[model samples]
Target: MADLNSLLDDLAAESAELEALVAPLPPEQWARPTPAAGWTIAHQIGHLTWTDEVATLAATDARTGSTDFTELLTEAAPRIATFVDDAAALAAGAPVPELLQRWQDGRAVLAEALRAVPADAKVAWFGPPMRPGSMATARLMETWAHGQDVADALGIRREPTDRLRAVAHIGVRTRDFAYAVRELPPPADEFRVELTAPSGAQWSWGPADAAQRISGSALDFCLLVTQRRHPDDLALQATGKQAMEWLTIAQAFAGPPGTGREAGVFS
Candidate 1:
C-alpha cells in the first residue's frame, strides 16, 4: 500500500498539471478531434470530472452501507451521457477560459475529497472495494492517460515525472483487474518487472527469481499498460508467455474494455 500522504500529494500535483495543460486552449480547440475517436478535449475533461464526482459518492456510500451510490450512478449515467453529448454541442460556443476554469474547480473538489479518505479504507469502486490509496492512484493514471490524448491532439509533449510511479503501480497491480474483467483466474506466479523510471533510475517488482521478466522504460510501460500507446511503439521486452499474455489485455480500469485510441492517432 502507498503512504497516504505521498498518494495525496501525487494526486494534488497531477490534478494541477492537468488543469494547467487545459487552461490555455482556444475555444475552437476544445471541440477539435482528439486521438480518441468521437471525443474532444471538452468531452475528455467532462468524463474525468464526472467520474471523480461519482467515485466520491461511492466512497461516501461505502461508509454508510447504503445503495445510494449504485442507484444514483445508474440513474445518473444517462444524464451524464446527455451532458457529454450536450457539452460537445456547446463546445464551439462555450468560452474556453471559463470552461477550463470549471474543470480546474471540479478537480480541486475531487482532490480534496480524495485527500480526506483514509489510505487503508476500502471504498466502493465501480464494483469492488478499493483502498483509498489505490483509488487515488487510479485517478492519477486516468488523468495522465486522458491528458495524453489532449496533448497529442495539440502537438504538445509533457515530460514524465517520478509521480508517474503511482500510475505505473496501478498498471502493474491491475494485472488481476484485467484478468477478472475477462472472467479468468489471475496467474499464480508473479512475473518480474524491471523498468527504467522516467528519471533514469531503475525500478523492479516481484521476486528476483521469477521466470518471467518485463523490461522497459517506465514511460513506455506506463503508456502500454494504460492503452494510451501500443506495445509496438515502445521498446518493452517481455520474456515468457504469461508476461506477453498480460500485455495483450492490460487494463488498469474496472469499466468495460476501452476501444483505445486508434494506432498512430497521435503520430
Candidate 2:
C-alpha cells in the first residue's frame, strides 16, 4: 500500500492550490458559471466542502458511515442526476467566503481523521470503501477536478504542479472503473497506460509493451478522467480499440458517467 501520510500532504497541497486561486478572486467570480452547467465557482468549492465533511465521517466511522453511504448509493443508483443536483443546489446556498472557510476547516479535520485511522482500515465512500492511502487520494482527485472547473470559470490557466501526479495515478488505476460504471466489462487484454506527469517525469501502469496502450501527458489523462476535457481537444493518443473506447468514457471519480466537457469549451 502507498504511504498514507504522503498522500495526505498531497491532498492538502491540491486543496490549498484551489483555495489560493479562489481567494484572490473578485466577489463576482464566485457567482460566475463554471464548465459544470448551472454551477458557479462557489458551488464547486461548496460541494468540495460538503464532500470533505462526509468523507471525514466515513474515514473515522466506516461501520455506520458505510451503512449511510449504502443507503445513499441505493437511492442514487437509478437517478444519480437527482442526487448530484440536490447536493449542489444545497451547497450553493452558502455564501462563498463561508464555503471556503468551511472547506478549509473540513479538510483540516479530514487530514487529522485520516491520519488517525489504522493503515489496514477501510473507509466508506460514494463508490467504494477505501483504505487510508486511497481515501486521501480520492479527496485529492476531487479537489483537483473541481479546481479545474474553478480555473476554467476564471479564465485562468493553473500551472500544473508535481502534486497533480497523484491525480494522474488515480486515473490510471481506475481504468476498469471507467468501464464498470458504464455496465461494460473490462477488456480481456490489459492495456498499458503511460503518462508524462506535470513534473516531466514518466509514470506507467500495466506492461510496457501491452500492445494495447494509451499514452499522453498526465494533465490530459487527468482531465479526461475527471470529465473536465474532451478527448477530441486533448493531445492523448490511443492505439487499441479498448483504449480508445476507455478514453471516451473515462471517469476516475465516483459519479454517474459525467457528461464530459463540451468540445471547444476549454480550447
Model 2 lowest lDDT segment of ten:
63-72
Worst ten in a row by lDDT for model 1:
83-92
Can you write out model 1's per-residue Cα lDDT over 109-138, one digit (the tens) per residue? 766666676656677766467877777788
Give the C-alpha miss distance for residue 195 in model 2, angstroms.
1.2
Query: Could you give me the TM-score of model 2 versus the true structure?
Result: 0.92
The list of candidate 1 runs beyond 4 A from truth reads 63-66, 76-98, 262-267
lDDT, candidate 2, 72-140, per-residue tens: 567778976677667776877877677777878999999998888787888877776788789898889
Number of clashes found in candidate 1: 0
Q: CA lDDT, every prediction?
A: 0.75, 0.83
Question: What TM-score against the true fold does each predicted structure earn?
Answer: 0.87, 0.92
lDDT, candidate 1, equals: 0.75
What are the runs in model 2 whose C-alpha is more than 4 Å off?
A: 63-80
